[model samples]
Target: MQAIIFVRLFRLLLGRQGPLLLSLLLWTALGI
Candidate 1:
């Protein structure tokens, strides 16, 4: 499912820029 993939990506980016990536993801999701 998309949620699973999102979680995986979240974990991957967490070490680098988790908050930034999370905000971007949420922003994109809301934009669509």
Candidate 2:
């Protein structure tokens, strides 16, 4: 399913970008 693919992509991004990705997510959530 699409959700599974998204989870896999998220994992890949976390593996590659780690903290940078997490910070970006927080900023996006805060609308900054």
Candidate 3:
């Protein structure tokens, strides 16, 4: 369940300045 959402977010953010933003998002997600 989480993996699926992670993958979708990864794809969506891949084109952006992703490393920092991605880590932040992943952290926030996990924090939830």
RMSD, each candidate, Å?
1.9, 2.7, 3.0
Candidate rank order under lDDT: 1, 3, 2
- Candidate 2 per-residue lDDT, tens place, 1-32, comes to 89689768877879866788778877987999
**lDDT of candidate 3 over 1-32, digit per residue (tens):** 89899788787877777788778877997996
Least well predicted 10-residue stretch by lDDT in candidate 1: 9-18
Residue 21 lDDT, candidate 2, scale 0-100 = 79
Let me know the TM-score candidate 1 reaches against the reference structure. 0.56
- Give candidate 2's error at residue 1 in angstroms: 12
Query: Candidate 3 regions off by >4 Å?
Result: 16-32
- Name the 10 consecutive residues with the lowest summed lDDT in model 2: 16-25
Q: Give the true-structure RMSD of model 2.
A: 2.7
